[model samples]
Target chain A: MLSETDISAISVTIKLALLSTAILIAIGTPLAWWLSQTKFKFKVVFEAIIALPLILPPTVLGFYLLMTLGSNSPLAGFLEYFGGGSIAFTFSGLVVGSVIYSLPFVVQPLQNSFSAVRIESLEVAATLGASNIDRFFTVAVPLARSGFITAAVLGFAHTVGEFGVVLMIGGNIPGETSVLSIAIYDHVEAMEYSQAHLLAGGLLVASFVMLIFVYLFNRHFSLVRSRDW
Target chain B: MIECQLKINLEGFTLDAKFSVPDQGITVIFGPSGSGKTTLLRAIAGLEKGDSGFLKVGDSIWQTDDNFVPTHKRQIGYVFQDAGLFDHLDVSGNLNYVKKRKTGLKKVFIDSIYTLLDIESLLNRRIGQLSGGEKQRVAIARALLTNPKILLLDEPLSALDLKRKNEILPYLDSLHNQLEIPILYVTHSQDETSRLADHIMLIEDGKIIGNGPINEMLTSFEMPLSHSGDAISIFEARVISRDTDFNLMHLEFNGGQFIVPDNALPIDSLVRIRVAARDVSITKKKQSDTSILNIFPAVVEEIVPEGNAQVIVRLTLNGVVLLACLTRKSSASLKLDKGSSVFVQVKSVAILN
Candidate 1:
């Protein structure tokens, strides 16, 4: 019963979530690893900054991102110098906003998992002739596999459910910036209750499934950890 | 030879140690808790970066002025107290981790190490399925496959209970002569020290107080080992014969022959025996009517008073060192002095290996 525009919106939402999650994982891994290992005095400041997106209103973050990517900003001017147009109200700008909005969703679990990796294990790997990078990939990454799964699922699910940030920076451009939540909002505003229910029910089911996966993964990981001395 | 002069300065503690140990056998770093023994071992492995340090193992320098080789680059194997095995890997995976890292090591040699540590049957099991002793054995086999020039074990048996410690000690004892590399073992247990150490380095208050072969270090009056209430002497002997009727074995040492309760070991096999200072009594003449079977003529070399009541007498029997603890009153009443001849009556001898 969905219209063609609604179908396009679903596809765009999935694409945006996938791309944002890929970028977040690529960048969040080292950041989380550093957060877990650093002994610096000011590490708490960085931790608070990363966690800001969690407590902050998404509209506030979207408002700032809008200003930063708008035609008047230096970022747009620099991109324009490289033959690119203003990113505001575009799919690229939607991705940038979604990445920042869901950063803590990806990074916090990863940092906790990396912190749980015992220092003794890493030191043993080093003595066994594993270099720093080798140790990170072979020991730290595999040991934190549950964290990676949780982070990816949460980042993708949170990005799919994004409403305010996409609305503020992307402005509901069909097939480009218009996503599932925006499409559902449009249906409710037009008083089309059946279409609203369709999208909203789908999203509710998807989010619940993702949460169930995360909890199951966490349980399995804890059980495995307890088996080790 | 492994030569080291390392200094580490922490918030309230400092570790300054310097010594040279032979590139063979087990050299125990003996100390009480919080005495910087672990810190010294870490520095040698390049795990703890000292403020200023110099370490040379064999001909290659690991750390020195303006140069430092990181832990991965240094050819040393380290075993932690908890075994530190990879929980994500099964037993075989843990053992093969080092094999995958280092190329050109023979598969046969690695298999021999597996057999030596008795972990062949455990290759398929998960690390979590292993008992405390099995985990340590796998950890040791994993380290040996790296073909290191020196092995560093930081209280490898401390995490295990007494039953498990006994289970793993034989494997550790065999590692001394089986491998050519020097092994630096850190332990606070006197039993482990006397059982394993070929050389001993005494640490106290973040400094090296004494360093020598285990025989001299254990019996030296100037050292703290002989002054303790549980002081002991260890000696090597060869099984001469076994009296099956009496359940006894005749053993020959550098000092004299000893008759011990039979252990079923074959004749001509080398064994280690421990004689605690408290188990020895001294008399002016050899007692012929006593039930004690082991008596030898010895000369007093030195006497160290242990508090106000007891004295630890260092004796030399046929050039072999032995320790005897006695009441200071008995020593004075008997007029025991340096170079005084006495008959040492050993009450019992415990076979260590």
Candidate 2:
């Protein structure tokens, strides 16, 4: 049996995952394309900055996001001026945290795939009368389709499993910010062993299935890729 | 006319080319490897940016001091060494890619291109499943469907094997006659040049050494094409008659009639033939009882010693220039010199369609 709080947590987790994955895709695609194509001298600095969240502790990222989205911070101040008030301890706050925490998951796959696209194909497309934007959509994007799928899946799965960043910026507010991972933690801390097992087991199965979907999809994609020559 | 004055600076290399070629027929950019021929083609297509240049194709100004047109807007079709077909698309899909982007081209024109390149049967095949020759044919058809003002082929057959190269060469040869646009072809092969070129641009070390008609360039003593071991001269001839009993055909050129070893061509058809300089020998008088059939009375226009052992003699045979490679010993014994009268005997001539 599940409590209303646990059910709300599950729904909130799905919402956060979906919204964060959407935002990450919108932001990551162009950023990844630029990273793949640019010859800028200081590009490594930007790359290292984007990659910092991957290796840094989740608590360290959560700590900084907390400061940036706090009630007195510039972003909160700007929102307050528009009567939007503080975003901390809200659903929107969780989405922002999740997107940052799972950024490298989406961007690295996209960047690698965009880099893998053959330059000859792009050049040939250009000579065939495709403009720059047209070439990106018609040639580079289709060639990087598998990367998009991997990025979206990984972004969603990673956001669903996030605990530390959510706890720091999005405090437990049952229907608002409390997600599956945080709910399982609350059940364990209360010594509700059976409830904890229920939530933990669901997360475990869901993660396994998500990973299987990725591997299976990628295997099928690679078969299509090998035939592409 | 296509005129270009392009200069590019790459690491450890610089391509400085300045030339104006007629915007008709095939003008082959012939040179050795690392001679900037491919770079010159890229610049003409606007794929490579030059420090400074002016390029004009027919009535369009592609590049000037203050203006530059990108590759897609330049109205030129370029074929790379490896047929750069989009692997993600099938053959028909590849052709449709260009048709969709460059609109207003007629369906009949596209179909004729498909027929010209013989790729209608391969419209649905995957690019990977195609043989090297089929891939090249599809690539060319895809380019021609764009209706470009000039077609630039950058070593289109260099990636193929010998059999595949031979297979695709006739298709390329027919392109010049069938299409009215100028084709700027780049090659390091002398054989490809002699068989395909109507005009020749000789490039060496990133500089244009000479540019002229193919006959003049190949017969010129100062050009690198003539000094090579496999130098050849091309002739435009008409099939005058055929000796079916001996599986031979007679071709009439400016020099004289040539008894070529061909049986497929019919009379009155126009064709190009190749005469290797090494296959030609000179004699003071014509021999009547010999097996050699092609002999003409010619005047020695120039004599240049090619290595220590070989000498190349330029002969004017009834207004047609022919090259003869003779040993230094024979040149001295025969007293061959400039302005001397000699009989030019050709051992063989290859029929080039």
Candidate 3:
């Protein structure tokens, strides 16, 4: 019973979540690694600031990002001068907002995973003549794979459920930034109960399945770790 | 020769140690816990940066005033106390990790390592599925695959039980004999030192108290080694004959013949034997009839009082010096003193190699 517009909205939501999750993982992994291993002063303060999105209202974040990346802002003006165009009310804008709003969901798990990696293993790799990058790829990445999986799932799922930030920054433009959540809201406002129910049910099932997979995978990871020890 | 002189100041303790080890054979850093043994090993491997030091490994200076090579640049294999194997990789994957990264690919042979450590059966098993002893063995094999110039073993056997230690000792002996690479082995257990070390460096309070051949340094009574329980005299012996009638093996050393209880060794094979101080008894005169079969003439060199109840006696038997521990009551009852001619009765001797 889903309409063509509803399918287009679902596809847009999937595309935005996937793209944002990929970007977040690529940028967040190194940041989380540095945060986990460093002993510098004010590290906790930086961590707290990175985690602010978890507690701060998503609309507040969307408002700040909307203003900062709009055409009137210096960032958009700089991009416009370079012929890149403005970022607000675009697909890229939704991606940028989703990455910021779900930053902690991707970073916290990665940081914890990198922290749980045994330092002695890294030292042993070094003594075995493995270079720094080699050691990171061979030892750190493989051992922290569970954390990566958790971070990816949480980031992707959280991005799919994002509403306030996308609404504020993206303006619900159809076939561009209007994701499934916004479409469901619009359908309800128009008294189209069937379409709204279908979209809502699909998201509920998808989120539930992703969360279930995370829990099952985490249990398997812990069992493997204990057996190894 | 490998010479190291390092002076590093930590929070509560300062490590100022200087020693030169031979280019081959195992040099054991024997000390008690919290005595900076592991720290010294780490410094040599360049994992730890010392305040000011010079490390010269046969013309290659790793660390000096202006040059400080990091650990990855230094070609040293370090085996930790816990056998820090990568839990995510299987044994073969762990071995191949270093093998694939090696530049020259000259000395390391995978099959040879598998044969040496008997890890052929464990190649498919995950590191998490391996037992403690198996993990340590795989760790050693993995380190060897890196084709390092030297091997640094920091108490690799400290985490295992006695049975596991016994199981892993032979592989270590084979490594010492076959590899032809210098090994810096750190340990607090005297039993491990006596069994595996060729050159022993006695470390106390972050200083080298004694450094020499294992047999000479252990029996010399000039250092704190005389106080350790498993302190014994090691002698190089060749198997002269095997008496199957009495289930005994006859071996010849500097002083005379000795009958040791051991099997699985061929005749004329060179072996090292350790005679514990507590297993040896000194007699004023040679006895004619007794259940003990091994007896040799010895002269008392010195007597060291170990504590209120026990005393350590140093004796020179022919050209070899041996140590024996006895109770103060027995020493007094026998009227034992320096320059006394006595017969040493060895109750039991352990074959180390």
Candidate 1 residue pairs in clash (backbone atoms < 3 Å) = none
* Candidate 2 docking classification: medium
**How does candidate 3 fare on TM-score?**
0.94
Candidate 3 per-residue C-alpha lDDT over B59-110 given as tens digits, one digit per residue, 9 for 90 to 100: 6789897889899888788899999888777888888778887766655477
In terms of docking quality, model 3 is medium
Task: Kindly report which residue stretches of model 2 are placed more than 4 angstroms away from their true locations once superposed.
Answer: none
Would you list the rank order by DockQ, best first?
1, 3, 2
> Which candidate's DockQ is highest?
1
Find the candidate with the highest TM-score and give its number. Answer: 1
Candidate 2 clashes between residue pairs 3 or more apart in a chain or in different chains: none
How good is model 2 by TM-score? 0.97
Residue-level lDDT of model 1, residues B1-353, one tens digit each, is: 99999999987889999899999999999999999999998888888897788999998899996789999999988998889999899898897889899999987998889889999899999988899999899998998888999999999999999999999999998898688999999999988998899999999989999999998999998888888989999989999998989999999998899999998999999988899999999999989999999999999999889899999999999999999999999999989999999999999999988
lDDT of 2 by residue, B172-239 (tens): 87897788999999998877887889899999889999998999999898787788667788878999
Instruction: Name the better of 1 and 3 by lDDT.
Output: 1
Which candidate number would show the highest lDDT if scored against the true structure? 1
Q: How far is A105's C-alpha from truth in model 2 (Å)? A: 0.8
Q: Give per-model TM-scores.
A: 0.98, 0.97, 0.94
Quote the RMSD, in angstroms, for model 3.
2.4
Candidate 1 true-interface contact recovery: 0.75
Error (Å) of candidate 2 at residue A117 is: 1.0
